[model samples]
Target chain A: MKKQQSRPNILVVNDDGITAPGIKNLIEVVQEIGNVVVVAPDGPQSGMGHAITIGKPLRFDRVDLYPGVEMYKCSGTPVDCVKLAVNKIFKGKKPDLCVSGVNHGLNNSINVIYSGTMSAAVEGAIEGIPSIGFSLDDFSQEADFGHCKKFIKAISLQVLEHGLPPATLLNVNFPKGDNLKGIKICRQANAKWAEEFDERKDPYERPYYWLTGVFQNNDKGEDTDVWALENDFVSVVPVQFDLTAHHAIPVLNTWTFDV
Target chain B: MKKQQSRPNILVVNDDGITAPGIKNLIEVVQEIGNVVVVAPDGPQSGMGHAITIGKPLRFDRVDLYPGVEMYKCSGTPVDCVKLAVNKIFKGKKPDLCVSGVNHGLNNSINVIYSGTMSAAVEGAIEGIPSIGFSLDDFSQEADFGHCKKFIKAISLQVLEHGLPPATLLNVNFPKGDNLKGIKICRQANAKWAEEFDERKDPYERPYYWLTGVFQNNDKGEDTDVWALENDFVSVVPVQFDLTAHHAIPVLNTWTFDV
Candidate 1:
């Protein structure tokens, strides 16, 4: 038998399937720090949101995608893949950490909700694991990942050294290819896409609509992730899954409802 | 002409179908409040999360389900329904208020992430409209909705009169049956479902698994939605869409990282 691999078990996952160059680069970086096990979708699941497949059966198959990384392509959402990785694939062996993405586009601000990449990281955090979701502002197949390796390694090492709080994960976004810059920890910018549906004609000459939009950032706060990324820095925001708006509860209680 | 049906423009939606008894009851109650416009899923989309279809073409058809309620079943997520309703159906005129679900079960605690019912309401809030997502703790088709009518009316009217703050909506979860003691404006409980998959054999002896889980509450605070619902009180949590952990930013900024 071959020598058993020994190192910290790092579960690697992404939304852009097992074949994306972004994930390939991510796996290569993760391999330096630990034994990487990739469990990703078989195809692109961009803008899938925090969806989980419940109506259908999920399947996982081992695939030889990354050269030395042990990888599996699963027929499920990003959240489902994390579940399968933790529950079935690594049943008895708990992973030291789970890292998702290095996604093609940004998951800053409200895009985090619609991001399958962040969902995987959030799922890992929910399972009480230290997790991080990384994204580049560039949305291209050939987007440069050279600048991200150092930062990724640094953050991963930090996460390993200092454990994350429960039910929380890091949402890390990098500026597209340019001269090197530093890193900044910031809050998720309060922003959204002002959607404008493009109405087009189909082959049958019927009107069809495509969901498209332009990102609009109304928040001008200097401490926001959007601002930080714009200022030539990698923005890291500690995202939590528990969306409790704790401050609003007291205000709501004062509302009179005498019925 | 049937007097042109001067009705009060109410938007009705749910995680369940347009034909579900929950929405039907909700529509009936709202019909007393406004002219109802029903836009919901074609089938049950429970635990669908906040998924919106970006890669597929959406199809919608008009159907006559509830008398005097103009209904349309859309092949899109709950958030998509709200979008389509705002863009296509009510292109020019805004509805009085968007109400989503007298849903089959509770969307308390961390269940809000996987809640399609709340997604619809969130979509409305994003569009600068007042919205509410109401759910009963009972997950049965025969769950009694008689007790919900009065409370629903009161809350909806209050929202109509005193408009909801921008980017915020109410997440109201009622206790099962008619013995609701009162209403409580509470925060979301620190709770999550511990997932357990049951592996079994299919007809051809093929292995398959079903997702199952138990709700685990780590918090016992009386000021929580879970606690209020458990004690026969309706829980109303004012929900906001901004996912930024603003408080953690300063703390994260203190961490040392190189360029």
Candidate 2:
């Protein structure tokens, strides 16, 4: 028998469950590049942050969602799906790269803190694997991802060729389908949500609340993810799991304590 | 007439509920330092992970808990408590410092990802204030915060004098009531939870799961928070909210595609 070439195993995951059009599009893109496997949540889990299902036994089903590409539907958080796929499902065989999202909306700025899409990517980084989270600035179910396919292929190939720095992953957000600008490697902008809760009465006259927020970016800097997305560019921000503020350690050491 | 001196205002909050003994002990220690104002969750909201109550109406109660201190119990997450305290409740007056936890257990290593206690402190830092989250390794209602009081007071007074760096907070973890070996200013080690979900049956025979995990430390460096805690010393790690991985930007910039 002739020696066979080894193909890179790519694990595709997303926060918007297994059946979302976002992941379906992502799967099609991955199939053109490498041997792909998808293990994602069964339902939408947006704003889940880096939360893992510790208080629940996760159930996973080997579903035939993406034909030819092995897929599993997991009943857990996005982080859980990544953990199960890496540890239990793959066992000792590590995937060459992990890609999450093509998320329905942008996970830019501080929104990444509460994002299931980004959390799946962050989990991959924590496990020392090269990973990327993709999101569109548009949140519509019918949003066009036609413009993002080429950029996704380029980024995925780069990651596969040159493995990412340990403890780092990419947060790639596409500008709302518009005329081409370009991709900008940027930093997370100084931004936050100005909360507005919508309260309405149910049929039984019981009040319910819906979370709403307006993005507030006071920073006028041009090198931020917010600025890039605003200029119709794909923002590629390298994100890490370590939260340490290395610059503050010296300042903390100077305070006088009675003890 | 002589003007009366206002006591140093200390805002006390935690991931554990307002009624937990941990906060009670925290209030007592803070009372000795200055005036205390507590705004914490009405019930236990551990593992909330910086989640704000954006989709709901918040209600608060001014309760008689700490005799001389003003306290409010809020129907929200820990991050919500900090927000309400800063924007709505305190109005124009900013506190000298915000303190979260004296939490029932450890927030060392990667546990800080899902920590509501640290999230409250991080929120405070975002608001341009010095903040700190203190946790003991013990997870008991009556876990001894006694031995850690001196260290806590020492650190708090230090932060009060020398403010933290912009967008940074301290994650301080004390080993559960043992003879202290002083303090260690350490970096957060690379560690993670080896999660094992325990499946159980409810009285109604429905299966439910509880989150359980064992802390696994792969890093053996002496300069780590894990090493400090293992050596019976209090570990202080300066944590930041900026999730961007700056080092990976150069690598991402090399990626190319036809735009």
Candidate 3:
């Protein structure tokens, strides 16, 4: 008989609140591999980025969600969920793997910076845990995650086996549905949301704005995450938390800082 | 007579709310260089990061905070303030330069990811504007910003003269006090907050948590932001919006994708 293997402890989280179907699918997939514990936002926190609630305290409580799968909901951003999980529940013993999302929207290219899903994963990486954030190109409550599960399981297992580079985490995004073209390791595309704020006056005659935008892809490279998703392929981009543009340092150094 | 160049249009913003002393100091510095338009949050959004307000409407209104400065206050995060400034105030005519903060606390090293000030600068860079986020090592309401003004004016002029590299912004932090040892070009230090949730109870006995932490600096490199601040030098790190760990892409591509 092979030596008895130990099950890894997996911490699951998402930005789309604790009850969202995307996270439910992720929970089911990871439960098959390890002992799962989920600490997610109590309400939708889409586009929260790396925000942490500073001026206010968080409301965290236990919830009876899926049977045999322990879960808790925190009234905070996705990053706060991970921090609470790591500090309160795990008690400094970090989970073997921290997986965020299977989000109901795309978080490729420049969207990563404004994505609560990826931010949760980035926080995990900062906390020294091997982490992956998964998202689908679709942004609907009923968006089916059927096709993405097997691939997520495979990729997560690989990460669990061969740990990621230090200070790095995986941002894995899937296209809509089962017409698979396999996985392609990619870089974040040079694209951004060309935002347009819809201005409307309230009943009291005060001006208010609603944020809306169009996804603009200017980078025509085939090796970008945007390209992979557009071509019906799974894109795995390795994201780093160190925002320092190291190459630009020498160029900036040349500038005289005299007043 | 010298060539009469049109005055640069400068957009000023901060996460420390519209009336903060830090932002007032920043506004004073930029008004000396260009035509200033201020759009900042109505309340302190210190750790809001790259978050954008999606689930709610924003209240954007003009305020007479300072005479001769066109200032507006938004009921949103710092990133939202930039978007509103671009969409409504600037009306697609992007500003010559965007300056965020003279933040009450330092946003060096790992704090960059969790900083609204830096995120605003990052947002400006994404919008093809030369941006800079300034911070001080002090965290007091009445922190002395007198010594920081001359240096800020000089740096802003230099950036206006020589535009930064594409997709890049500056994360500039000053040491507290009058004895600044000039500027130092640096990289973000490898440091992080060793966070511990301060648990407490409300009136009904339900537990709540207050996020608090001590910064832990593991990187000993002299060319880092932490080092520059420690040496009483103003640190300027060229920051990028591209979150891709491009170096790790090839290594990930080598992994087989078959389940």
Top candidate by TM-score: 3
Runs of candidate 2 with Cα error greater than 4 angstroms are A1-5, A196-211, B1-5, B53-69, B91-94, B197-212, B257-259
CA-based DockQ, model 3: 0.88
List the candidates' TM-scores in order. Answer: 0.93, 0.89, 0.99
Q: What is candidate 3's TM-score against the reference?
A: 0.99
lDDT of 3 by residue, A1-259 (tens): 9998899999999999999999999999999999999999999999999999989999999999899999999999999999999999999999999999989999999999999999999999999999999999888998999999999999999999889988899999999979988999999999988899888999999888999999999999999999999898999999999999998998898898765
TM-score of 2: 0.89
User: What order do candidates take by DockQ, descending?
Assistant: 3, 1, 2
Question: Model 1 chain B, poorest ten-residue lDDT window?
Answer: B250-259
Which candidate achieves the best DockQ against the true structure? 3
Q: What share of the true interface contacts does each candidate keep?
A: 0.51, 0.51, 0.90
Q: Give the alpha carbon lDDT tens digit for every residue of A12-104 in model 1.
A: 999888788889989989899898899999998877677787777766778996577788888878888888888887884679889999899
RMSD of 1: 4.0
